[model samples]
Structure formats: structure tokens, C-alpha cells
Target: MKKVIEKKVYNTETATLIAEYWNGLGEDDFMYCEEYLYRTRKGSYFLRGSGGPLTKYSESNENQTWGISTIIPISKEEAYEWLEANDKTEAIEEYFSNDIDEA
Candidate 1:
């Protein structure tokens, strides 16, 4: 079984991680995806998604064939939906809470 990873990560592309749903550390799949939820200092919520394929299908396939990508400002509704689909209760509460945070 793949080991579960629980650690903090800093991605300057988006905001820092407030609640890490999937770290994708010990995954051995061909395509691995990681989801991290963050809240800016102004209380704005954002989900930082980052991932890529583990191996290339061809030797000359370095032209970005796969659709692996990371979107910076994922919609609040979409973020909530993702959280709910993943069953992140604690993150769900913190996501809609009145507390402030820093990215």
C-alpha cells in the first residue's frame, strides 16, 4: 500500500497550503495529482492543484502532451464541491469559518 503523507508544502505559484487534502508524496501511479487548500490573509479561499505524469510515453514526448495543469484561482463553489467530494469535513468547516489567515 502507498504510504500516507502528511506535511506542509509551500507553492509560490498560488498561496501557501492551509489544509492539505492530498500530498501525492508516496504515490507510484503514472499520473499523480495533489490538492492543497489555502486561505489568503484577506480571508479569500483558494485551492492549489499541482501534478504531472510519472513517466513519459515516448522518448521524444517532452512537448507537453498530457493535460496536466494547475489553475490558480479555483472558484469558491468548485472548491467547496471538491472538498465535499473528497469528504474533507475539517477543511470544510475551516473553509467557511470566520477566522482569518495568511497565505
Candidate 2:
């Protein structure tokens, strides 16, 4: 399965959209995706997931310091596509199987 990396939002509306999308997928189908909510300085939010690269690029970038505040199960493909459509290419990468949890 292809994975999308990350998404950043500054408001609740976007966060709601993410939640809605996850809920729409149905619980039985959630194994295909993973979603996480992160907070940076000043309350900024980040929505990220596992799938692509084994190496987390953010660990080498400024976002390495960002704190993950929550985690949820969502469609990995959907998140990846959204990132691609929105031109968030920097959020996508190749990841190793061991880096992700099978759950």
C-alpha cells in the first residue's frame, strides 16, 4: 500500500475534516491506514501517518522537534493522495516495514 506522509493545519475545521474522513472509512477497513495528530509550538497542528519511507525525514528537518499529541486510524491511501494533490511532496517518502506497526 502506498502511504502519504504528513499534513499540517492551523484550525479546527481542517482537523474535523480529517476526523470525518477517518470515520467514513468504517472500522473494519481501518487496517489499511494509520493517522496521527501532532502539535508544534504555539498550538499549530500536524496530521501525519506511516506508509512511505522507512526513514522519517522530519527527524532531520525543523519539524523533528514537533510533538505528537494524538494518534488515530485512517486511510493511508487517502492521506497520501491528499498530500499529493495539495503539493505536500515534502511529506512523502519511502519507509521500511519494521518502522511501522502491523496493527
Candidate 3:
């Protein structure tokens, strides 16, 4: 028989914040971070296969796997706070700096 691995990868505080943002999901709501790698940012996480904002699917044509999505706590001082709180990972080079770009 194959072993069923547990899917909770987050530390207590991060997990608690995520739970608050996306409440009502059950234990099996979705896969965990360790199931696949993820990039955690100030207000959201970008999964491997994300196709930017315009496309729902990932940009890679050869890839078959759909990208994952995650919720993040929203606040005005989010980016600064996030860097201070978490490990100092690589700096994000590109991001939408304007609200109009989202549409």
C-alpha cells in the first residue's frame, strides 16, 4: 500500500493567515505547497504554470499541468512587511504596479 503523506507545509502563523483569507475550505480543499513548489509574495502566490493575468492557463504550450493558486493577506504595507517577516528570497523584478494594468 502506498503511504498517504500529510499536506500541511506552512508554519502556524502563515497557515493561520491563509485559513482566514480562504475560510470554509475543508481538510481536502486543495493540494499543499510541498506537493508543488510555489512563490509567495506580499498579496498572492504565483504557481509554476500561471499564464499571467490575461490567461487563466499557463503560457507553456508543452506543459500539461494546470497552475495552482493561493490567497494572501491584503494590506497597504504588505510588500515591506512580507520581506521583513519571511526569509529574504530573490527580489521580484516584474509586477503590475498599476491597477489599470490588471484590466
Candidates sorted by lDDT, descending order? 1, 2, 3
Task: Assess candidate 2 and give its TM-score to the true structure.
Answer: 0.23
- Candidate 3 per-residue lDDT, tens place, 22-99, comes to 223333333222111223333433222222222343223464433333322233345433433443233311322342
The collision pairs in model 1 are none
Which digits, one per residue and each the tens of the lDDT, describe model 1 over residues 1-103?
1111234333434454556655455445546567667654554555555454653221226574442434355556766776778888687777656443445
Instruction: Please give the CA lDDT of all the candidate structures.
Output: 0.53, 0.36, 0.29
After TM-score superposition, the amount by which residue 63's alpha carbon in candidate 3 deviates from its true location, in angstroms, is 32
Error of 3 at 67 (Å): 13
Structural similarity to truth (TM-score) of each candidate: 0.52, 0.23, 0.20
Q: Per-residue lDDT for 1-103 in model 2, tens only?
A: 1122365334433343322122233333323234444333443334554321222211235543321223333345545555555544344443113333444
Clashes of 3: 0
Q: List the residue pairs that clash in candidate 3.
A: none
Model 1: how far is 36 from its true place, Å?
Answer: 0.6
Candidate 2, poorest ten consecutive residues by summed lDDT:
51-60
Off by over 4 Å in 3: 1-31, 34-68, 71-73, 89-103
